[model samples]
Structures are given as structure tokens and as C-alpha cells.
Target: MARPVISCERHSLRGLLAVALALLLVCAVSAGVSAGQAGAQGLTPQQLAGQRVIYSYRGLTPPQSLLDDIRAGRAAGVIFFGENISSPEQIAGVVAQLRQAQAESPISRPLLLMTDQEGGLVRRLPGAPVPSAKQVGQSPDPVAAAFDAGLGAGRNLRGVGMNVNLAPVLDVFDTPGNFIDRTQRSFSDNPFAVAALGSAFITAQQGTGVAATAKHFPGLGTAPAGQNTDTGPVTLPADLSRLRSVDELPYPAAVFVGVKLVMLSWAIYPALDADRPAGLSPMIVDRELRGRNGFRGVTITDALEAESLNAFGTTGQRAVAAAAAGMDLILCSARDTGQGESATTALADAYAGGQLDPAAFDQAVARVDALRAGLR
Candidate 1:
């Protein structure tokens, strides 16, 4: 016998309940999937495809345009200057506010807040009751002094919610008239002393959960007399033996002790790379520091907006080139006025135009991510 045919209009109430229940299950599953995607941290390949670093004007507060770019993961980092400082309390407030904005941003990663707290003339938080590197170097026990000073500086910075301190000028300070060293920013003229004090500072700062960066790497210690690399393209005429002995000594010590960031100098080292400054030379960054030196941390460029590279290219072009040359971070100090903004925008444009290779960009982002992830 043929089974009784049930018309659609005559469907049982039980069948209707089952259909409704199935639909509800599907909706619940869909909702979960959407939530998972929303909760994911970091940017997708499409998001970071075309991005760069930017700076804000002091006393003007962070602009909506800059904030929007950062929230969209189009900006890399911010470089703080002396003008960005008011008082320790005020500085702390600004740092906290920046972090809050980052937390609310769609990008889940933390914003890299950088400052040139290298002590003496380069210090951002001056008069914070901390001793200069010169003072630490002059102490009978330089290592102990550096450790204590670094601890104090780290505590003060961490209290203010800052995570990075661009410090412990690795430059040897051989030139007595050198502006950076004449002001006592360098630890010592003796390479061993510099290495010892620098390593101590790195340990002490990182010990307190603040990442310490060794600055002006490959040794700005050998700059020409009466010339600062900040204002011009200074060159050092050291032989390979001199560089290895005096310039490159402190770097290995810094790496061996776990310093997380190293900032490359903009000065030219004819002995190393005559055509390009260390900041823009792949041989210096990739071959020398990364390969020969075996440094596995993040490498940043000194301010691209500095006069050192003003003749080479626009701030944006220099920044893009630095990244291509293997720098993980590009600094654009506000001291350059609006140049930082232009450079950052240029980097964003480069990313969009495919001038920056995707693989290289991803590699940089990954290294930065790893270093930050390991931070306490």
C-alpha cells in the first residue's frame, strides 16, 4: 500500500518544533564563529599590507587622523621627545593614555612607545633624580652604579607605563669634542669599560621588565671631531681591526646579556660600507650585525628625520629604505617637526605600492611581536 502523503500545510507540530530547533542551533553556531573572529588579536596580512610609522606634534595632543591610522594598524610606532615631556606625572599620564588607546584599537598588539632616555643630553625625563652615564662610568664600581641607575630608571619608566628606553649609548665616545660624549652620554672611552657598564645597564633595565636599547650601534664613538651625526653625515675611517676591537666589542656583550633592541647609526663607516650609512646598509645590518655578530633581537634605525640622511632622500623614502635594509623599527623624532608625519605617510604609501616586499615586512613584524611577547 502507498504511504499516506502529508501535504505541506498538514505538517505535524512536532515536525515544526524540530525544524525550529535545527535553525536555532545553526544560528548559535554562526554567532560563535563571528565572535571568535572579532576576538582575534593582531592584524591580518591585508591590514598590515600598507603601513608606516608616524609622530604627533607636541602641545597639540594626538590628532584624530593619527589616532585613526594607528587604530587601523597603518602606523608602526611613536617617538617621544623632550617636548613631549612636562613632568614625570604628566609623562606618565600621556603614556597611560596612549596604551589605553592601543587597547581599544582593533589591533590587539601593544603600541611601541619609544624615548631617547640615553642620559645626559639625550634624556627625556631629565631631573628625575637619576645619575648620568658619565657619573655611572666614573664611579669606582661602574658596573654596580650602572645596575643601580638602570634599575632606578626602569622603575620610574615602568611606573609611567613606558616599556622601552633608548639608552646606554654604545658609542665609544673616543672623540673628546663629540657632542654626545662631551655632554657625558657615552659610558667611557675605554671599550672594555663601555661594554661592562652597558651590559650591566641592560641587565638591570630588563631585570625590571623595561626593554633597554643599545643605541648608535657599530659605534658612533669614532665620529669626526666637532661633528655630530645627528646634524650631518659623519664618517669614521677605522680599519676592520679597529672596528672589531673598539666599536664592535660592546655589541656582543649587549647581545650576550639579552638586550632586546639595537639602534643603528646614520653615520657612514667608510671601512664598513662607503656607499651607504649603517642605517641604510644591508651589509651592515643584515650581514655584519645579524649574520656575523649573531644578534637575534629587534634592530631599529636612529631617527630617519635626522639631518644625517636629509640629503639622501625624503624622510619617507629613508624610512622605507631602512626597513628594506632590515631595520625592524623606524624612529621619527618630533624634533624634525612635521617631517615625521610625512615620512610615516610615505612608508604607508610604499607598503601600498608594493615597494616593500610582503615577506620582509612580515618578518619584521614577527620579530617585533616575538620580542614584545617575551616582555614581562
Candidate 2:
């Protein structure tokens, strides 16, 4: 069955979502203070656009250009990699530097300092969440292990001045040696088990003030053993029923537990919308995620530099498309300052050029602000 087209801003559940978003603004955690209210007023078009982007850089120290972007209100936050950390103290100092820069800008809220701290080999930082999700599931006490991993990850990230951990993967793979299972990423093949573990992780992690992201939705369990979305495109052809019953099963549990962010996948889902990736599809993002499941928190893209998006044109074009499709934050993790600038500029152009709806854009930026409001 084909999905009927609907405006991203015209969902029938607007009344309920407004209340949900307001609650999101009230749940500040981890560090700093909630200086940001849920509004995008007094911002220039470019600054408004900048509030929707998360930038990244290479090496140990972030470039002055990146700091300048923050100071100028042209950046919302940044994602970190292992290459950017030498020690906990070093990255903590780097976070302090960025925070000071952010203080000078119009936006006074804490910058979303984040990393892929999913545990085991996937963590960017050096410690905590030592056990993989797969191992946790295979343990005698899976629920306890999940909570421990989440608590460990949250404390680890918060101690280093970081606020978000892109972790607790909820992908429910079907077979052994599959992509998620092979990397020890997914908790279990059972959707109910994934839901319980993921909820436990979220509850424990967010209690420590550092927010956790439930990623690669609507689930990447079907991704092949060797096919990576980072290098190229991969389409999962699961039917709508299976996608809802299995892939999307854990999301409701996560949302109920108040997960701060959700990272959508670049992989295309023919059952949802075959024309574009889940992150760039209105049916998948606005309809399936928001309208159907009521996930009103921040929606982040997987990574803007993925080779899977070559067909979508350049960074600016892609950013505009994602934003128009109801995504709130664009993750540009190429480790190049220029890549981020390009995306920021393109979004500013789109907003200024009337390519994006004013009401919806403001609402989207406010949603990002709402997430930032929950952070220190």
C-alpha cells in the first residue's frame, strides 16, 4: 500500500505533540543550565539555520574556524571521534573551550557535545559500558546489564563534559552473523527483548544527565552482513507489517522512557518510502515516526557525508531536503569544518529563499532548542 501524501506540519496530532514538546523542554539534565526556551526568536535566518546542524572536526583539537562558527551562532553542537580525544581531561578541556565560545553567542544553552559511545568496540571514549549490547542480552541478567551499560555510558560521557551518547542500538536482527549481531550491536533478535533492554538503558542513562540516542531507525536489523551505509546505499525491503511489528517495536518503549534523540538511517526502506532514505522521507520521518508512533523528540540524520547520499546531490541540497522532510538536526561528521559550513549555508539559503515553510521551520528549530534545553 502506498502512503498518502500529507504536509509535515499538518498532522492531526498537533495538539498532543505541542504538549509533548513542552514536556521535553522541562526535562533538563546532565550539566549546565537550561538557558534555552522553546523558541527561535531574535535569530537571523542564518543563525536559525545553524541551530539545526551538528558539526565535527578532525584530529585532537577543534579548529578555530569551528569555534568562530559557534561564536557567530552558526553552529548548534558538535560530534566527537576517537581521533579528537587524547585523555578524558583533554576532551573535557576541549568541551570547556567550545562552551566558552557558545557563551559568546546569542544561543546560551549547552552545545550538544556527543560521540558514538555505544559500548565495546563502537565507543569513541576510553571507558565504561565495557560490555557490548549483544553480550548484555546473552548474559544471565540481561536487564541488569542493560541498565549498567547505560549508567556507565552516561556517567562516562558526563564526566568528560559531553552531553549525548549515540548509543543503545535497538536494532533487532533476525540471524547470527548479520551486520548488527556480528558487531555485537543489537541486544536481541526478539523485539520485546530489545524494547525492555533499550528502555532500561534509556532510563538509567538519562537519569545521569547525559542523553542517549536510539539509533538507525526505523531499525537497521535487516542490513546485510557486509553492507555499510557509510560507504554506500543499502535498501531493506521488509514489508510494512514486519517493519512495524519488529523494526519499530522498540521505539515506543524508548520514547516512553524519554530518549532525548533518535538517529534515522540512510538506508532506504521500500515498504515505507522507496524514493529516499528514511532520514529524508516525509512518510517515514513525519508520518511513520511522528504521526504513527508519536516520537516528538529531536530527529537527527545518520551522517551527512555518507556515500549513500551521492544521489541526493551536495550537502546543502541534502540538508534542505532533510529539514523539509521533518528532521531537526543534521549531523555533518566528515571531520571537515568546511563540510559543516556548506551545510549551514545551504540551509540558511533554503530558509531565506522560501524553500522551507516558515511556521514549520520555526517549529523545527524550536524542537532542536527544546532538546538543547534539556541539556546542560
Candidate 3:
């Protein structure tokens, strides 16, 4: 048998197969470890561990500690006020830094950079303000102008690294003396017209990757006389039928157009719930908007730090209560120079103390994650 000699080629082939198998085993072990790490770091723990705290930033550059907190998944989102903005370029730079910090975070979720860019008086970024919704409605081609304005606003916001514009006030201008409408924020007293133009605005906004929020839902335009819902108790007088006809018209239109965020009003609709504002009312937030209207989007509470809510409870308590009432984001509660540590600690305490249901918290986090995924 010629010394039973094995060919050099066969020996090389056998060695190659052994090396290949070793490599594959090593790769499989590495993959298993990576997957196990990911499974161990599931979102449920993070979601149930704390509340999503949104704070305002005023400095030209965000502090490194603040950025680190965001990167560590300690903060949820940031809102920029007029004090934080001097010009569009400055705003852009600040937002870029924030986004960069967010990118470096362990979690890859989108960091919500939000502003009240509704135009007119509520505009946060100056030198690029579009006319109010009312002004857009004043144009003969309201749809075209509204669309252009929305596109323009979205472009401006996106230019500065903002993903959300708290805009397109859907409140019908039924009351002439209403502060928001008096400032020309409302589109029209006519529900149909408001619906049409508001939808156009939302379409333009979302068309450019900037999510538009149809705000003060259930309609702040119907707030009782001598009351600004942001400051005091607000009562909506419209019956369900009337609400469906007027105040609720633009919301569904926006929803139909695929709006990503809806901001609940601090205003209380006596017909809907006599005790709590829309933001904290289960009947209104969970039942009316989420259930009745089929708005399967992220629902945010109006600034929890607002005076109207200050009368109800401490900022931390209000935040936990609002989350319980179906709000996904707690905005404007940051203490300590827009750091939001107090609010974050408050939420963490609530979670640990069993005041907030872990399941409910997880659901809200899932909704927020879904919204961010859609953006991606």
C-alpha cells in the first residue's frame, strides 16, 4: 500500500477544515455572548426604572454632564425656549451637540429635540418665524401657503437638528378673547376650514421629517371667559356632539394625515371630565383621544410646570400622575438649570415606591419607541 502515504493536498484540506470549524465555533460563542448581553439589557427594565423627563436648555453649549445624562438614558427629550436661542445658527449648533451626545448613548433611540415653533408669539426660534396659522388661513390659497409655511418651518427646524415642532394649534377660534387665538394662533372659527388648513400644515410638517403636534386637544378655543388654561382652571362648554363637530374636527384630520404627536391641553372639558384637565383626565386622554379618535400616536402632556398644573400638585407628583393618565412625555419640569435631575429622581422614586404601575410605564415607553422608530 505504498506506505499508505497521504497526499499533501489532502493534508492541507483537512487542516483547512479544522481551522474553519474552529473559527465558526469561536464566532458562535461570540454571537451568543452578544445576544445574551442584549437580552439582559432589555427595554422593560429601562422603561420601568424611570419617567421620561424633558428639560429646557438655555446655554449656547449644553454642559457635558447634561449630555452624559442623556447619553446614559437618564433623560428622555429636550425643549428649547427663547432664552436658549439667540439665532437660527446658534440653535442649530446647540441641537447638533445634543444629537451628537444622543448618538453616543447606549440606547439608539431618537432624542426628541422639540420647540414651540407655532409662529406668531409662541415662536421659539426667531429670524425664521412663519406667520401664524390664522395668517396662513387669511391667504386666499390657504392650503398652498399653509403647506409652504409648514415645509419652510420644517426645513428651518430640521436645519437646526430639531425633530419635533409643537405647532398647528388645532383649537378653533370660537372665543374672540381667548389668549391663544387672540394672538392669531387659531386657523379659523369654522371647524371645517380649521380642519382643512390644519391638515395642510401637519402634512407639510411631517412631509419634511419634522413631526407636527396638534396641540391643546379637545380644543382650548372654547375655554371659559377670564381664564387662560395655562394659568388657571379651564372649562370647555361644548357638548359631545358639538365637540365632535368643531373642536374635534381638526384632530382626526391631522390623525388621518398621520401626525406623530398630539399634545394634550391643560384645559378641562366639563362635558368630558369635570375634575381633571385633558392632560390628566383618563376619560379625555385615554378614552376620548386614544380610544374614541383612534389616535395611536405618542400623547404628550402640556408643560407639567405650567401654573395650571402647579395648583394641582408638585412637579414630580404631577409628572407621575400624568404618566398614569396616559401621557408619554413629561415636558418642561427640569429644575437646576434645565438638568431635570429633580424630575428624573421624582419619577424614579415613583417607580420604586409602587406609585406608578410598571406595566403602564412600559406601554408608554413602547409607544414612544414606536414613534421614534417610524421617524427612523
Candidate 4:
């Protein structure tokens, strides 16, 4: 009966439909396999690890080792320090060489040439445009002055081929002789004043196409005896409510004005998390800075080589911990290439071994890439 009913057109159509279905299934299986292999094969370990690290090197131009690292996609950027500077033109030359080296790498994202150009003593580049944060803070029209200062700083930074200026110290330290105030870094003891001034600087810098960083998050204003975290571990004794009201005040304003990055302090806050430094604490990095304060910018560790992290672990371990804690950029500004290389290696190993949270790593990289994209 079926033999009498079947037509050639209908028989051919059925065969084609069956073939299409098989092909679709095969494609789906192939895609699944590729996705499964992606974690191990899609991105090299160096790429994953290097994307998270910002390193410093010795000499006017980037060292050959650094150039090799850049070419191999094993370095994110170079940070300029006091020794790396002689003049604006000299720094410009060095940055030009870095870009030239980066061109050899397959990664198209521009290297984040950054410095602690926060004005006053912290300004790494010579001839910074703005005066000390104290000078700006105490100015007759602080907001406007800060705006001008930020503009000047941004212009100078961009002039030398640097794209990121780690400035606008947002700490609200009120304690007499605290490092934040003594260094002329904090805008003011008053959080609202700090907020206003910091926002102005952030606005002006980013407006000039140079990204601004609001630093030492949650405040270092109250460190007893002006205790420096760089020499050893220190704790912020303020309770959660005080920290929110006092220490964290400046960040919201900075966030409101669209700061591009927030430098996490190495100082531990018992109110946030008692056991770990802020840069190594999820409660401080993810919960407080990102969640509570609504800072959507990149999260960077202050410096991995800081002695504050000595109690925690070695530089490599600290770097991995910082990433796991939610930091996007690992700052290895101590002038030792080994520290940066070792840290990158450790991070890559951790990610490859499934020691780091995959979601966290992806989010960190996304934020970092997005920030870098802003420079381009």
C-alpha cells in the first residue's frame, strides 16, 4: 500500500530532513567539546595571569625582560616610579618604547602606563600640574581648584603617553599626624569635604581622557600614631557604622562622579573583616567597596610588595589572594621583575588548577579590560 502512495519529491524531502538533523546534532556536540576545552586551551595561562598584573621595571626604558614579557602577553602594563622619571620628555620617550614593544604582542589593548601622580609628594612624574592635596583641599574654592588641578595633572600625564593617573587620594584621615595627612595626600579630615574635592579631581582627570583613581578605600585617616601599613600590618578600629559614615564617605562622591579605579588599602578593617588586609579581604573589596559604596570601577591592590602583606604570605600568594578577594589589577611596584613574574605564574597556576573561582577571575578580567578599553 505504501509503495503505491509514495512520490519521489516526498521521499527526497524526508532524506534531506534526516541529514539536516544529524548535522545539527554533530555541530552541537562539537561546540560542547570546544567549550569544555576552552578553559584549558582557549587562553594561555600567561594571558590570563598577565592581564591581572601591573608591573614596574628598572631603567628609563622598559627592561628587555619586560619587553619580552609584553611581547609574550605576560605583562599588563608598566608603572612609573621616582626612578623611572627624569623629565616629562624622558618619560615620554620611555612610554613610546613601551608602546613600540607592545605592538609586537598579539594583544591589541593598550598598555596601562600608570603612576602615583596624586599631587604633592606622591606625584611620581616630575612637574606634576597640581599642588599637594593639602594645598588643593585648603584652597579658597576647593572644588574648582581641584577641577583645575585634575585637569593639569591629566594633561601632564597624557602628554607623556601615560593613560592612567593614580590620583585623588580620597582618605578622610582626621587624626593629627596620620600618614595620610602628613604626606599631604588626604583632601581633608572632613568626609564631605574630601568627597567634594575628590569628586572634582575625578571628574577633571577622566574628562581629560586620563583615568583617575580614588585611593586607600574606606579611609586611612584614623590610623593610630600615623601607623604606616607599608612597614607592617595595621588595623582600622572603626566599627561598621562609623566606617560607613566616616571612612567610606569620600568614595560615594567619587563613584557618583565616575572614577575609573579604586585602590584598595592594605590596612585591615576589623569592622569589615578582621583577619585579612582590605586588599586581601572579600568583605572589603567585593562587599564594601563594590557592593555597599556602589563603586563600579576597577579594583586595584595598593602594592603587592607592601610589608603589610608579609604576615599574609609571599608576593605570589598575596597576588593570588588579592585576585580571589576581588582585585582586578595586581600592583607590583617594587622594581623587582621576579616578583611580578612569580605572581603571574602563581595566579596562572591557581586558575589552571581550579584553585581560583572562575566567575571571580572572569569578572576581574572583564573590569580590567573595560577600564583599558576606556583609554583606547
List the global CA lDDT of all models: 0.68, 0.83, 0.70, 0.77
The segments of candidate 4 whose C-alpha lies over 4 angstroms from its true place after superposition are 1-41
* Runs with alpha carbons beyond 4 Å of true place in candidate 3: 1-51, 127-129, 333-339
Most lDDT-accurate candidate: 2
lDDT of 1 by residue, 225-341 (tens): 788777877888788898888888788777767778888998888888998999899999988888777677788888776787877787778878898898877776655435555
lDDT of 4 by residue, 1-376 (tens): 0011111222233432332233223211111000111122255877878988998988666678888888887888888988888898888998888898888876777889999888878887776555888888676656556667788888889989999988888888677777877788877777766776676676677767898888888778888764899888888778888889988977776776667888989898888788999988888887898788887768888988888888778888998999888888899988978888998999999988899987678767767766776684
* TM-score for all models, in order of appearance: 0.83, 0.90, 0.84, 0.87
Q: Deviation in angstroms for 342 in model 4?
A: 0.6
Better of 1 and 4 by TM-score: 4
The residue pairs that clash in candidate 2, if any, are 30-209, 31-376
Ranking the candidates on TM-score from highest down gives 2, 4, 3, 1
Candidate numbers, best lDDT first, in rank order: 2, 4, 3, 1
Q: What lDDT tens digits, residue by residue, belong to model 3 across residues 1-376? A: 0111112222233432332233223211111000011111554334333326676655666677678777777666788877778888888888778878778866677778888888767787774446888887676555556666777778778878888889878888887777866788987777766766676667667777888888888888877667886676667788888887778877766676777788999987778888888899888888889777778778888877777776677777787788788887788634343426656666777776778886676667666666565453
Cα lDDT tens digits for candidate 2, 1-376: 1111212222123422332333234432332112234466688988999999999999999999999999999998999999999999999999999999999998877799999988877988889999889888777656667778888899999998999899889998775665677789998787877876787777778888888899889999988767778889998868899999999988887777678888899999999998999999999998988878778788899999899999999998999999999988999999998988999999999899999997788877877887787788
Q: Which model is ahead, 1 or 4, in terms of lDDT?
A: 4
